[model samples]
Target chain A: MPQKNTLIYSNWWKYAGAALVLYSLIGGLLFVNPNNLLFLDETVRNLNYHVPMWFAMISLLCISVANSIMYLKTFNPKFDIIASKSAEVAVFFGIMGLATGSFWAKFSWGTWWTTDYKLNGAAIGELIYFAYLILRNSVEEQNKKARLSAVYSIFAFPLFIVFIIVLPKLASNSMHPGSGDTVGFNKYPLNNNLRMTFYPAILGWIAISWWITTLLIRIENLKSIENTDEN
Target chain B: MLLGLVSHNMFAQTTENPFYSNGKIYVVVAVISIIFTGIIIFLIRIDRKLKKTEKEINKKNQHKD
Candidate 1:
């Protein structure tokens, strides 16, 4: 029903995403880790599953905020729908990322939750978006709801970036990778084995995120159509 | 004796992979299963939503008629 030519709505991408994710799931299990790093050991395979989740979450959040900005500029209700639904999917993936990370951490760090900067930052970012959802539901008027949430989304995104990306790097003795004094995963470049699985997983997750958001948009459209029919 | 032979063959096959020695392969299986389960649940939720929407629209059409 959209007049615009957006790549997100395409069926081919959905198929491709499903295929890539299936491939990654199989590969992540079968492909042998080259170095077999310590502490991580066999759980290093979780990198394909756990890390791509954060990548998908960030990508969805980026799409959500971009649509929010577009809504502000054009004031289109459709953009509002896209923005909100994308954020909803983003939150879903973020929670999954946290849960998987916690599971991984329990084995790797010997704790389910840590006071690490990155962990706390990710928690705060998730809370900020949860607040954004609460703020949206509080308003009844359509335009006002969209405008306020759009503004809030734009404001929160930069804080999210700072929390998840910047603050972790600044703190010393943080538990996560790429933090101060820690080499992180980047210490060893992903060899062909890891790269083959990793890249496909990222694409698959992003595609799945897009597929879910579009389904949500379609549902919203149906509701709106029903409302108009009643009128 | 037959049961023991089957169990021994299973164990031998599993032990063939060096990665299986650490019991880490099960972790990989668990993670993949969790992801697949999550996706299945999501699909079911969407299907439920679509069915509800269809019923509502059909009821509205009947009322109009």
Candidate 2:
């Protein structure tokens, strides 16, 4: 029943760990052919990990936001915990995405921080997500916390879309691929051979990270359920 | 994507592109982060519901006891 299912989440690490190992091996094979890898200079290899992670992270956030809305609608405490837990997993991935991306940027853009539209927009997003976490902590009332957080989460999603998507298009031109007037957005063309590796990298990261984020939500839900029943 | 093959290009030992900076790195990173954050916010609600059910169960048990 619920108890039996709870065990599944507790042991999620096994699945996540195994997936990581598999991805690493796959990455290794792609890395073996450095010359033909995407980005041409071995720099695009970061996309395998970085790009997928960003997708996984956002996917996790999307789920979390949905859960938050449910909490507000149903006034359910369990929803809030699941939402919080998912955010934790999301944050973990997000930070990694940022780090790996910044590392790539240093090589691709000449500096860690750039004065371009896309970079600035991203920094703002990082701050907003960070603020989302902080805002959650600042509140104590269960009812109030759930309501306020839900409101904030909903508001934030659109802002993210605007900053990450819309604004970049309307702003200044950037050397950062497909940002401004770069016909077809920043879809950096990956070589066919490299695409073989890079595309899978995206798939692998998303599959693995999505599983972990789901596992985290399940764990928090179960643990909180146990705590309440015991009391 | 700019390798800056110009004369003053950064002295990259190999014919590697010296001008290629991680400019779009932030956008990619932000997109990743935004997605993750969205997921967590959703999960929080699920956790709260589970807690509610647990609470109801406990109340029933207390009355029975």
Candidate 3:
């Protein structure tokens, strides 16, 4: 279990997050979308669902990378456990983002997959993280595994950002909004009603993602503590 | 208000696309349902993890006894 004073041990935020998520679902569906984009009419509501996955992923991965840095500085096994578990949750969110994006593309772009820079970049970025997990598993010695994985995570975070955010913008064409020529939802697509749900949705999803990561970390702690006791 | 009128007009208008069917409201339902299902699946995973941990703890306690 996390320290009693820690956010992970606190129950209020988890309940708040659940309430916000439920509100977002109902309000997201009910909110009026004023923008009448050609292909993305009613599906504009997907903004509340799809975009938040990436936001949650990025937030959790930021935590993961921060913990990795902490581990490198202190060589603490606890930090390494936190780093790995958060990364695992972040990858789960990234996969959700990819799956939802693919489904959205099928309707709007008229294809399940496309040659677009952002889409390919997102996929490749996930593959890099997958390699990070594989890298963690291949090494056996506890400290060595933690040290190596932390270093890999530190190096990979920048590359992941470049692949998902930077490369998409640098490329001449991208189907995704806020990249290439297409303006973000803030410019025109999102009106006040949509914003009411959108911001809360992102916050809520990120909160839930962190909650899940903390749970995983607790489980890891329990198992590792048991191992130490037996040894 | 003007915003109300615009939204009413928005809902009044309909298109032939599948997304626009039932004033495109069902699309929102579908998206919400998918997300709900995903959350439920995550809950199930957490439950399984808790169960495994409980079993481990029980085994350790038995050994101590």
Candidate 4:
């Protein structure tokens, strides 16, 4: 068995995550929306759910890349396990974000998907991480796989940033907020009630992602132990 | 004074949405709540399965020892 001190997990944040998300769910639906917004209507409530998924995705990807860097520096398999699991959770959130955004757009923009820069950027960013998963699977040796993927993650993360953040701003016809003529959340501005719920929703999602990743890492550790025993 | 301010504000803002007034918004809320509940339950199930697997592995290790 591994040392007890080595395996540090906290239950407090897990409960907090669940509670915050519950609060957000209740507050997000019932809270008073600011009156008279063009196109968005009642669907502006999606901001509490959809926007936060992207925030959680970005946060997870940052953790993934940070772990990748740590793996390179320390050559620890544990860090690589975490890095890979974080990316997996990030991809899960990215897909959720895309689905939610597409649903929102269908109502607001009158289409499921757009040819806009932000949409394409988000698609490409998701594709890059998907390709990272494929790269991991293709490698035969574990150490070589970890090393190569860590390098790829470190390099690709900046390009991913450019796709989602930088490119949208540069493009003229982008429909997402803070780009072109589009008014963002700032222009409409979340009321005090919405802000209270929204911030907690982001925290809740990040905590949930962390919980899932830790569970995955623990499973992998158990599998490794089983493999070593068989050998 | 606070009661006067509250009454004044209530009269001042006459925002109208048919869905909210008719209680249809609660339907939407119910649907969202169900979806969120389902996802959380699924996560909890997965966590339980992992815990079971860990326990089985620990048992096997103890048997080997």
Candidate 5:
């Protein structure tokens, strides 16, 4: 278990996160967009809810990969548990990003799914992580599973970055903003008014996600501790 | 026919659907609701697991006593 003094065990950040999210929820809807977005209309407010999911996913997965590296160096089962739990939360956020993105696309792009580079790239990236989970389940030995999945995660992170972040930028005709010829939403659609909520929304979402990850980590730690006691 | 009604609802983006009305403010409400619901469900699952863990701990303590 993380010591009581440790930041993860601290309760302040969770409350702060909840407060910021509440502020964003009210501010996101109440704040008027200074610019009229073509094809987005009122759905422009989805920026506060949808965009944050990807940010939180990337942050959590980065933590997961970092823990995997730590596991490799120290051979600590704790690090392996943290890495897997982080990946689990990251995958959940990724799915939420996809679902919300699909809904947003249906309104703006006139389709639920699209052939856009970013869309396809995100889908493929999600599948790779799903495969990682399946690979872990396939191995029975604890140490071997940890070692193998740690190595896999080390490799998977780079591939995930390439698919979800890099390839889209390289694709010339990609419809996603910030990829290809299109500028990000920050360039035109997001005015100072929207930024007020957008930045906090991202921070709040990341904090909330980390809160959940820590809870899962504590649960896993408790389970292991109990098993050790039994034996 | 029911098929025609379903197709019209899907293809026509019917305003009769409550979410499409009132300048579509309800869409924002729907998005917010979905996010909140997802978070609550996650917390509920965690709560159940924690409860089970607590019960096990209590049983172990009783056995020790």
Candidate 6:
């Protein structure tokens, strides 16, 4: 048996949020607001929040896919619950990311919607996740629903990567900087302030997403138990 | 600009610009976000407690049966 940790129920993310706010204030006072810090461009200011959302969404999708694959291997309904709830959280964050990204674009690029590679790729990825929900719902049989959802979620992993990866390379026009240009990912400039805040924001968002997903899964499991008893 | 000089040519509507200089909008947004998180947390707790209660009820019924 695995050792039960008391820390599991601890509200760690609340403390993490406090630390993040404190760091943001200190960083602003010391490194950012001082020395006339113009390192991060005005538009890139939103990147601290928005970019991390995309990263977190992708990470949640990955967990959903992994749980799906596990369900396929073990033929377990428990794994299906994990997969479904994770997918639900992923889709929620994915849509929110898209909405916030559009807001950013509106402020920075003078348009609410654009054909930029990142924007378009994200739209398609949202559609793919939406399809997973639609597919699971349209089916009737309990076992077939679980089995088919598992199989479909497995395919989403590769399809998501392919759709997102291909857009940046395509000759299609994009308003995003370095869209058509073949600049190496590492060599592309990210200012020091952005580097520090961006990575931690992604980590924080990932933790928060997992927290939300876990809550949803427990609720779903409770509902299932109720259903079984009633039947 | 989406926001521009308002003219009397258009009928005056205070609620139309609810996001004016008033801090009310910000406070409302903050409250909503907090409430949303609180609701999710509350739902999870309720679900857990209900499940436990349901189990106990079922157990009592089973013993009677």
Best candidate according to DockQ: 4
In CAPRI terms, where does candidate 3 land?
incorrect
DockQ comparisons of all candidates to the true complex: 0.14, 0.04, 0.20, 0.35, 0.07, 0.04
- Give the proportion of true interface contacts each model preserves, from 0 to 1: 0.15, 0.00, 0.15, 0.37, 0.07, 0.00
The DockQ-derived docking category for candidate 1 is incorrect
Assess every candidate by TM-score.
0.80, 0.66, 0.81, 0.86, 0.80, 0.69
Question: Alpha-carbon error at A46 in model 6, in Å?
Answer: 0.5
lDDT of 3 by residue, A127-227 (tens): 98999999999999999999999999999999999999998898887778988877677787444367778889999898888888878887787778688
Compose the digit string of candidate 5's lDDT tens values, residues A99-199.
99999988888899989889999999999899999999999999999999999999999999999989999988877888877778878844426776788
Weakest 10 consecutive residues of candidate 6 chain A by summed lDDT = A28-37
Looking at model 5, residue B9 earns an lDDT score of 41
RMSD of each: 6.7, 11.0, 4.6, 3.6, 9.0, 10.2
Candidate 3 residue B31 Cα shift, in angstroms, is: 11
Candidate 6 residues lying further than 4 Å off, grouped into runs, are A1-40, A169-173, A177-192, B1-65
- Candidate 4 lDDT, A18-117, residue by residue in tens: 7788778876766635456566667766767898888888988998999999999999887898899889989999999999999888888899999988
Q: Estimate how well candidate 3 is docked, as a DockQ score.
A: 0.20
What is the per-residue lDDT of model 4 for residues B4-54, given as tens digits with 9 covering 90 to 100?
744343333334555455666678778877887888788778877877887
- Give one digit per residue, the lDDT tens place, for model 6 in B1-65: 31232222111323333322353544654554566457556645754675476567557556755
Whole-model lDDT, candidate 1?
Answer: 0.81
Error of 5 at A76 (Å): 0.9
Every candidate's TM-score, chain A alone: 0.94, 0.79, 0.95, 0.93, 0.95, 0.81
Across A124-212, the per-residue lDDT of candidate 1 in tens digits comes to 99999999999999999989999999999999999998998899999887877788667777577654256767889999989887888
C-alpha lDDT (0 to 100) for residue B45 of candidate 4: 80
